[model samples]
Target: MHDSSVFLIEFGAIILGLGLLGRLAGRLRFSPIPLYLLAGLAFGEGGLYPLGTSEEFVAIGAEIGVVLLLLMLGLEYTASDLVSNLKTQYPAGLVDAALNALPGAAMALLLGWGPVAAVVLAGVTWISSSGVIAKVLGDLGRLGNRETPVILSILVLEDLSMAVYLPIITALLAGVGLAAGSLTLAVALGVAGLVLLIAVRYGRHISRFVSSDDSEKLLLVVLGLTLLVAGIAQKLQVSAAVGAFLVGIALSGEVAEGAHHLLAPLRDLFAAVFFVFFGLHTDPSSIPPVLLPALALAFVTTLTKIATGYWAAKRAGISARGRWRAGGTLVARGEFSIVIAGLAVTAGIEPSLGPLATAYVLILVILGPLTARYTEPLARRLTRRPRPEQPLAPPAQATPVDDQDTVGRT
Candidate 1:
């Protein structure tokens, strides 16, 4: 067979398979991410039917997938929204970092992976998938709940934090000197602040500059601009994903909406490819050895995330049930986790990190929805058990649940 023919067949099969997996996940009311990852494993280096001709193409698609994921995420918030959430929710963000990130870092140290791997692992655990959480909230019809804002505020903080965090990891993974890494960090912070300033003050101008009546033109311009910025950011050692996100933030109004509509399909395609690419590089055989550790990590982090959400919601004066729901909703970790681990895996920082991350993510992403739906109910049920010894008190008047500040549904 000609190499071109082989490439066409291989890539076509992968796409078709991803579409089917996505449909299956939809029918099951679950995220398609785990299925995509599993498919990648089935076609990976140590698994069945590895591709010979299309791996390079897949790798390129995967990089674009990461950029698109971050870009779309940034589009979900305006600069004003970010500032508001930051003011109201900085404490939750702090607790989130302390609870979820610390465990991963501790695990890395326990495994003797050193400081760089520890930093990378901390990030892998720190971020919850905004993509997954948003879907679950919509599916569960809890978007209008009082605690929803609390959940979103934390997610926004995480997304913004990546603008700074990605550069630090990049420098560490590349084994740059302290001075060079400090310079890179400074540049990243400066860029992030400048972009935020531009987004807040000149977002309308940017949108107008990028806007087009023609759909094709709009798509082309937005995609081209994202890739160009991403490339330059990578050249500057500032992380391509951050550049793409900043671009997304800088655009507003009609341009942001049009770009989102035009780019969503591409984002889905590339994001699926990105997950597959992560799975493709991981040796399936390596996963078994790490499965127990991954399960343990997932369990511990799940509890920590719940605590983070609960504390944040309680602080916001949400109802008990809403607080539990908020905690449960934030338990899933998806795209960002893989992206973080993928970087370290590519750098050969630790051989076991990839497989461990794969196993951990698989457990949590699947578990995330269940927790979101049932956490409040389960907590209620447990507390409602009748005590045999105490005399039953007269039932108190039922208090009306007032979910105030119920704005921002879409």
Candidate 2:
């Protein structure tokens, strides 16, 4: 009874704290992610106070948080959209990877963290925060902007690439033999391909099968199926988040919309927990030692992400203003960065990696909204040249000879 009471108290406090943080963020017109992380830090290993009973529960919720985050992201588009984006926007995706990823990998190598950490850090810098970006778009009312589709396409490609990237990273971190790793990669790819194919071809049927007039039944069915698929994927050495995303892609139409509405609150709640859980595992003192590196990395990657967005928007023929907006919008790195770093930290790849990631994400997540709002205006202000004033042209003199010119014809 005492333990149960303690668990209830701790969990209640967490939820209430999250609620207050969310409200504060809402009032401040910003994402609650950073505040959530700060809260986690305060209650974590090296923070002001740590919890005992509820930590386990928070861990489980954090995992689900990741799964739901990817799943909902997948639900935002159809497989046809994914295929089309892959065909057309792939170059932008490649450029994004090359430009943003190299900095983190180079930093890792320069720090002598070895090849594995370099790869992990590369992933950390490569993917932008889809969740944060989505929120920024909605908040700033930029969802209807010309550059938005270009931004979405780039995000889709990044997420799809994860189906391949996550498996390879998993295998690498495990230090499995080449043959075994290849087998793992093959299986992951095969499953992902099959899911995408089905989503494209028979998505309607899948949606119909899952759909119901009753919201209660619909919620239960969708939630259960997602968790099941995510679990199976994890067991198969693929990312559970990928599995959940595929499941999301397989459902479309009203069913997808309904599921999105039903699951949104849950997604927000657990996602906050996920960020907090990430902070829970990092030592506070460690963050300061790596703050300089994190800031340096944040600065470099911020520029790279802006460049990537600008390039992609320009390729799509967006106006200069829209291109700048697109570039600014992609500057934030939130959930996915931490997700990649969490994997590396779990593998015990580097001691400083987690703290650095935490600090780096904190900086970007806060700076993200500000940049999204100001980048274009700032760019225009700085690069805009003053137009020279043209002297007013003298009024044309009245043609006194007009009558004489007409008289000859008359």
Candidate 3:
């Protein structure tokens, strides 16, 4: 009875603190991710005053947080969309991996962390933060810009790649041999292919099966299904995140929309907890030792991400300004990077990895928004390029992109 009371008091205070921090971040027009990590650090193992009872609950919440994060991300597109993006935008995806992932792999090897840790860190650096980028696009009104589709295509490809990448990492971290790891990869690929096939052919039927007019029933059913699949996936040695993502892809139309609308708040709450939970396990003192390495990584990857965006946009024939925007937009790394590092940390792969990832993400997540807003303008200033001049009289307005049929075409 005493323990229960303490748990309630500690957790209640945590939620309240997160709320206040989130509010502060909103006022500053910044993501609250860094602040949440800081909160966790202050209250975690080596920090000010760690809580005893709530750590277990926070751990569970964090896992759910990761599952929900991937699930909702899947809901944003159809299986067909993933296929199409892969077909059309794979060049960008390959370039993205080569440019962004290699640096991380190099860093890990340079630190003598071995091949497995290298692969893990490669993922940590390769993927951009979809959540942060989506928000920046909305806030900046770039949704209709010429390069927006290019940016989105790159993001979609990244999401698709994770379906395969997560399983390989999971197997590697488990210390499975080559034969067993190959089997795991084959299984993951087969499952992904099967799910995509089902989604492409019978998605509507699946949606109908899950659909409910009552919001309460709908919410429970969808959430229950996601968790169930996630658990089974974990049991099968596939990543639970991949399973949740597949479930999301399997639902479409009204069902997907309703599920997304219903699940977003829950996702946000759990996702915040997940980040804090990661911090809870990391010692604050470990971070300073890794701070310089994290900074170097963050700097190098920022440029590489920009280069990737620029190259991708150029391939799609975007203008100089739009290209810069696309590159700048991909600079921030967030949830996915941590998700990768979290797997490694949980596997006890390297003592320094968790601290390094924590510091690295904190730096980039904060810088992501600033880069998104400024990189293009900064490029212009550096080049001393004058803005295209308008005629004295209001020139004939160009036809809308749809009518003109080109500028923003993907």
Worst 10 residues of 3 by lDDT: 400-409
* Tens-digit lDDT string for candidate 1 (264-377): 999999999999999999989999999988998999999999999999999988878888999999999999999999999999999999999999999999999999999989
TM-score of model 1 (CA atoms): 0.95
TM-score of each: 0.95, 0.94, 0.94
Regions of model 1 farther than 4 Å from truth: 385-410
Work out how many backbone clashes candidate 1 has. 0
Q: What is the lDDT of residue 155 in candidate 2?
A: 88
Error at 338, model 2, angstroms: 1.1
lDDT of each: 0.93, 0.90, 0.92
lDDT of model 1 at residue 376?
A: 88
